[model samples]
Target: MHRFLIPKELKILVETARRSCLKKPDLFRRGGYHRDLQEIRWLLDNVESWNAESRISSVSAYSILEAIVLFFDCLPDSLFPSQLYSTIMDASKSFKNSLEIYNCLPEINANVFVYLITFLKLVHSHSSENDTDLPLFADTFADVLIKPPAALSLSQIPKSDRDSKRKFLGYFLANDVSHLFQIDLLLTRDEYPLLARHLVRTGTN
Candidate 1:
């Protein structure tokens, strides 16, 4: 198991993003901004035997990737391209181990979905701002394409039973699932233009 340390660079990025979001209250709801900031703080303050290894694990890797994507999305377009690409590449490579780790923690599926959605948003935003072609790797939905069997299996569960059990679990766990949908919606809106253009251009080719 690879030990995961919170890199100083990531810490700085999270803090900077949090500060930027906080400064622009009009751009995002207060509650959303606070939630984002709190998530970062939790990541920073928490210490567990798994903290180091979590980045390599599929379940935890998604959470880490989602946080990074969110932070990166808030950054100025003028930021160093090479640095951003290097960071994303590292995260993508690490996520390759997510399948093994995911087997150990089935409940983290929602987090994985959210992370992929966030990643899509990041790539779309990058393409839009740079007026450049979208990276091919960004074309597929990683969570859906890479883990469809797992997702389909989950979807096979009876809706009534699933809802009943989820209701009993109350707001906290329910909110986690809802967050995935929220992230999905955000990504859909963010990437629609790029996706449309890509589809049109690809069809012609």
Candidate 2:
């Protein structure tokens, strides 16, 4: 199994998100979810690296996952169709393949799987109502790509488990270019701070 490492493409995505955030911090403050979307795109793009064994420090993982949720909560619809979506999806798939190589680490595997599942859910939720069988597509993607564990009910997982799941899923989802192109639901405040801290740490390191 290949270990996770931040990819060059994902680094570019993060830079774009940071630029967007700098360009309009107030937009994010005033409920502009687009800025948040950019940030999520960046985090998800690099989730595999963040979840990789060598990279599995709590601070780093939390920082990346927290950014994803925060950006998700704050992003607006106008950002859809941006090129960033395609980048996120491509990166996510690449990382997912790397993760599959090292499934022995249940903690990492579980967390990454949940993050991917969440991304699929977000995609399903965000797709246009007119789009045919979007939900079915999401389920199908999860079935084939994720194969969630029977012992792991997301709701029943502890905070650490939930955090790991979110982190992994965030990376997995970012690979789906469609996520970059649509808006489903905003992330909750409860999910923000943790990810934000992760973002800060990632930036510095």
Candidate 3:
């Protein structure tokens, strides 16, 4: 239930799908079609054994993407954190200000956010080759990244508010995150020590 640090399950899901999503143009954009609740739950329960078993390997990229989205959706606070909702959704907020806002996130949250956004940016860079649409990605991820304060319900969000939030996500997709983060996509090596620690699944975790 803690909303600060991301869990191992999420890292596993994203890492597992990283290659396929990047290489298969459709996988990153379309994600996967099998967003079944049962599958997501099954993934959550069994992600610990991912390296030891082939079960998770058989799951579609769509299900992996769905499980990742569901994980954030169920967090005590959404990825952007409720306290910054208004500031983040402000349409007039400058691109510089958005980078500042990202710095405001807790260390772990910021790292993970940068990590995920960096991946999204990479996928977007291949948009022409991958055929992924940024607007749709923005719309779908808006609810996941930003939302009404904890006191409010998603059902209560107005259309204008929704649009603003989606636009906010689009900014991250459009910009380079290296200004605020140190991200190396090739996590297979030992460089970028700080990020390498977060990307890998440790026995102690």
Candidate 4:
């Protein structure tokens, strides 16, 4: 492939979680599957080929959400790579800094990063039924998406800076990163937009 396509698996998991969690009160409290590595692998492998609209009743919200979390875990270079961690933090409270940070990322990283943020923003918007507020969502994802330091024992990342990644992520969740990522979620568009279409908007923009 000329360019690494944003993994359809991530899209599949996001879409699956979106459907599984809708209108379900305290879905996080119900808690789907997070620890079952075997099950998570199965979900990723099986649904990787399935269309975004496709769904099965057996899949639980927690399982889908956990799968998404693991998706980030599987990344060799995090959504916010360690090299740019400082730049991202500097931009945390400034729109101009956010744009600069966006420009600094690789195309694939930028697109996938935006895609994920878009999906999570949608999830947060419906937090009323799911009991997932922006802070909770941001804090939950910070560990996965934000790479603290290559070596915690080494004197690389400062202690205070290490502790504040979640606050920065919460800032992003509360603001607009869509302008950075042009992709539009299917939920906002057609009744059942394909992942391809959901992502295709980036090309047009």
Candidate 5:
């Protein structure tokens, strides 16, 4: 199901997430254009070209996923000041699709998925502290926490698998390299297996 990698639905989700990022005008410093954001916008706009194996390497697909996570991670906590809950809730719906397919994705993309989920959990936590009314992402947050991503299960990985083409989302989850990629800093107890697996992989390879 390589088609799952870059389908119309995935493209729409990226576009919607991009639009949500742009809605926060203060994301850019006064008088300075957000050149970095433009890169992500371009990626969203040219989804077809990037997904084309002949045009850009398929490795670039992970770039698209990483860029989406970075967009929200880089934003200030004050994003969508006036309508934070509604706007992020809408955006989270788009991201929830990624979460559903977390196991099917490649390494970097899967890491991005975990990071996004963590980000949403933090957002929901903050919102509920005062509002009492849970944010829209509450359900998604709960669902992900209950199952955790299959990618994060280090003990389940086979010992002899070494095909480079093999997707490593699960491997990444069981590893400690998330910090190297600027993913969320707070590692949960469930992520300890990830660190152990990462160490084993690094030593063996």
Candidate 6:
């Protein structure tokens, strides 16, 4: 598979988006999910600016995508109206569809892609009055990162980089999951036993 270059600026922009969503959950609340649509629209408009100057590695691209997933996962349901769910899901689907233009170098992490797709599909289609499954998506996200379903042997990624990537995932899952748990408890008072389990596992490691 051919590798696609990800610009440093684009990566930083994605991280910024994540931070905006997490650190300031209300940033997109004014317009609801449409605010997210605006963010995606802006990214699409700037897609042309993601040139090959000081391009990022393929692994970094995957990390950036993971951050995007985190960004969406962090979005609060209270801030988004029920009617906008489909719009948000459609926007996310379109964004993922755009990613298909560039082959994920060496190999695509099927686990990550599948988990994100499933999370989005469930959220987009759910009709229950109570949104009990909100934390489930966050838990599943942390699970996917901490223990990726399968690690494919890829020639493009060196052993050292692979090990580093694993370490990074572990670190991210450990800190991010705990932080998310606190946020959820404070914001929604939701119980997330999965988050607790992962935190213990992370602590043990």
lDDT of each: 0.30, 0.33, 0.59, 0.59, 0.31, 0.29
TM-score of each: 0.21, 0.22, 0.71, 0.72, 0.23, 0.23
Candidate 5 off by > 4 Å = 1-100, 129-135, 138-205
> On residues 32-84, what C-alpha lDDT tens digit does candidate 3 reach at each position?
44434354455545455465124454566565565556555665566677889
Is candidate 1 or 5 superior in TM-score? 5
Candidate 4 scores a C-alpha RMSD against the true structure in Å of 8.9
The residue pairs in collision within model 1 are 4-52, 4-53, 58-98
Q: Give lDDT tens digits, candidate 4, residues 143-172.
A: 778775576544766666644666666656
- In model 3, which runs have C-alpha deviations exceeding 4 angstroms? 1-6, 23-44, 47-54, 153-156, 183-205
Off by over 4 Å in 4: 1-5, 27-31, 34-37, 46-48, 51-57, 152-159, 183-205
The list of candidate 2 runs beyond 4 A from truth reads 1-66, 69-102, 129-197, 201-205
Whole-model lDDT, candidate 6? 0.29
For candidate 6, the per-residue lDDT at 53 reads 19
Root-mean-square deviation of every model: 19.2, 18.7, 7.9, 8.9, 19.5, 20.7
How would you order the candidates by lDDT, starting with the best?
A: 3, 4, 2, 5, 1, 6
The candidate maximizing TM-score is: 4
Question: How well is each residue in 1-205 modelled by candidate 6, as lDDT tens digits?
Answer: 2222222332343434333223322221122233333344344334443432122122232233343444333332211222332233233233343233112211222222332333333332332421324333334343233221123235533444334333323332323222111111111113221121110001000
- Better by TM-score, candidate 6 or 2: 6
Q: What is the lDDT of candidate 1?
A: 0.30
By lDDT, the better pick of 4 and 5 is 4
**lDDT, candidate 5, 1-205, per-residue tens:** 1111222323333444343332322221122224433444454345553342222222233343334333333322211222222222223333343233443434433444455444333333444232312233332122222222234455753332222102122232223333423422333224323221110001000
| Residue 3 alpha-carbon offset, candidate 6, angstroms | 13
